[model samples]
Target: MKYIKIKRVMDFIFSLILLIVISPIMLCAAVAIKCGGQGPVLFKQERPGKDGVIFTIYKFRTMRLETEKDGHPLSDMERMTRVGMMLRKLSIDELPQLLNILRGNMSFIGPRPLLIQYLERYTPEQMRRHDVTPGISGWAQINGRNGIDWETRFEYDLWYVKNISFLTDLKIFLGTLAVILGTRGVNQSKSQTMEEFGVATKSLKG
Candidate 1:
């Protein structure tokens, strides 16, 4: 349990320092978002955290609030503004979640939090991901991000839960930084943002 305590301390300290270091960038992103369109600068959504606890996760708004003439939502691709696309491609949209880490709502390394509604869809085995606090950067994200299939993503998440350690967290942190630094691209929409986890699937059946 030493490393677990270390992880929480690191989450608080590093998140605080990084937020201060990156405040300028976050501010610029906010300004750009405002200049781009009419919408909130931050996109806050309810996500499941440790042990299925619901919490509001924050990210920079990376899409426009565009609706059709009839006021229905537009497709993700269609609603994505140019600035938003660039922000996502550079992984800058995730910078705000550093605050979530500092706030104890998330960890620096664990399973990335997913939609609250996906709670009931997970099998008992898959639901094991909630055994640890959710994270901003995780094993699944450093692997293929949204490019991988759902089953594969869940597998990586569960693996992380079972094998978490100081070295594991360090490795994931370095790997995620490599992604943000352009050594590896974190494509948020190679297919799409893995948003279709609402239905129970046979792959998740015990």
Candidate 2:
């Protein structure tokens, strides 16, 4: 239990340091997102954090503002700009989450914060994924990211929740670097995000 306290301190200190160290890159990313399209530089969305609490998650905007081309809605891939794609490829879009970490809304390592809508879909067991603070990169992320199915991802998340430790976190941190550098498991679809969690997948009562 003391490690939880240690992890929070480390999350705060490291997030602060990393933000300062990466400010230049963050600035360029912001500018590029701004000039790349007509939308806001930063994308903000509500996500469920620990205990299913809602919090605003931040990322560099990686999709165009327009939802439709000519009455028909554009697909996510079609709406993605070249610069946005580059940022997503390099994981630059996630850098803004350091602010979330600093604010105690997230961790550097843990189960990832998922969509607000997913709150109701999770079974009682699956909802345990939020027993700890969400992270920028997590066990499910390093293992398969968006490439894996929701059930498997939730399993890995719960595994991490049960086994969180310095060594486990270290492994995830190093593995995250490899995943980013190797561009592994980055997408489950051409949309570059996971498909929505379906109600049909809820096998257990909430």
Candidate 3:
């Protein structure tokens, strides 16, 4: 109880400080996004958070809106603009999530919130990830991020949830910084981002 309260306080304080420090960079990112192409400056999507609650997650728009000859949307790589590519490489596109942290919709450290549509796809054990607030970075992210398989990712998330502590969060936070600086595991092979978890096998009932 004490730790949870302390962590929440730390999250609030750090989020505010970082928001102030990164305002200029965020403004620059917004302008760059506008100059890159047409579309909203921010991309908002509903994601499952702590206790399976849903919240709108915010990110800087990094893809151009376009349709194919069949009127279907193009792949993420196809829609990625030059500036978008740069922003993604530097992870500047994730800065908007600071607002989520400020709103208490997220934490600085926890399992990364996944799409809401995946709720029914999770196995009973996997569903434990929602036991804590989602985060901009997590044990899974710092481990192998998009480079790992879904099973491994969930295992890492569960591990973090079961062993969450100040020291653990600090290690994951620092590891995230290293991963971002190295620009590692930003995307999976043959995809601009990690693939979504669609319908799960019937054997692994949610």
Candidate 4:
């Protein structure tokens, strides 16, 4: 209990410091997005937080709002602009999420919050991931991130949830830095991001 409180405090303080430190980069990213195309500078989406609570997560817009001939949206890679791709590759697109951390919707280290629509799709074991506040980066992120399968990702999330500690968070933070520097695990195979989970299956045992 005390550790959780301390973690939250650290998360808040570090996030505030980071926001201030990266404000310039964020501004540059916003300008770059505007120059790239016409769309909102920030991409807001609802994601599930601790205990299945919903919250608005913020990220820099890294894809152009493009449509198909029939007016449907194009695929992520297709809609991704040159500047957007650079932002994603450098992880500049995620800088805005520090605001989410400041707002208490996220933490510096925990499981990455997933789409809200995926709430109902989680198996009982997978549901355990929501036991703690979501994070900017976590064990799964450092281990394989989008490079791993969904089941493996959830397994790592659950593991972190069950064994959260200051040391664990520190490791994840350092690992995230390495990943950003190395530019690995930014996207999944053959896709800019991992594909969405359609429906929960009985065979999905987390």
Q: Give candidate 2 misplaced runs (Cα > 4 Å).
A: 199-206
Superposed Cα deviation of residue 7, candidate 3 (Å): 0.8
TM-score of 2: 0.95
For candidate 1, write residues 82-183 as lDDT tens digits.
898888878888889998999999987999998877787888989999999999889998988776767989999999999999889889989888877763
Which of candidates 1 and 2 reaches a greater TM-score? 2
- Of 3 and 4, the candidate ahead on lDDT is 3
> Model 3 over residues 4-93: C-alpha lDDT tens digits?
889888899999999999999999999988987779999999999999988999999988777553877677777788888888878899
Question: On a 0 to 1 TM-score scale, where does candidate 1 land against the true structure?
Answer: 0.91
lDDT of each: 0.84, 0.89, 0.87, 0.85
Query: Best-fitting candidate, measured by TM-score?
Result: 2
Clashing pairs in 2: none
Which residue pairs does candidate 1 place in steric collision?
Answer: none
* TM-score of structure candidate 3: 0.93
Instruction: For residues 20-108, write the lDDT of model 2, one tens digit per residue.
Output: 99999999998887777687899999999998889999999988889898799888788888998888778999999999999999999
Ten residues in a row with the worst lDDT in model 3? 197-206
- TM-scores, all models, native as reference: 0.91, 0.95, 0.93, 0.93
Show the lowest summed lDDT stretch of 10 residues, model 1.
183-192
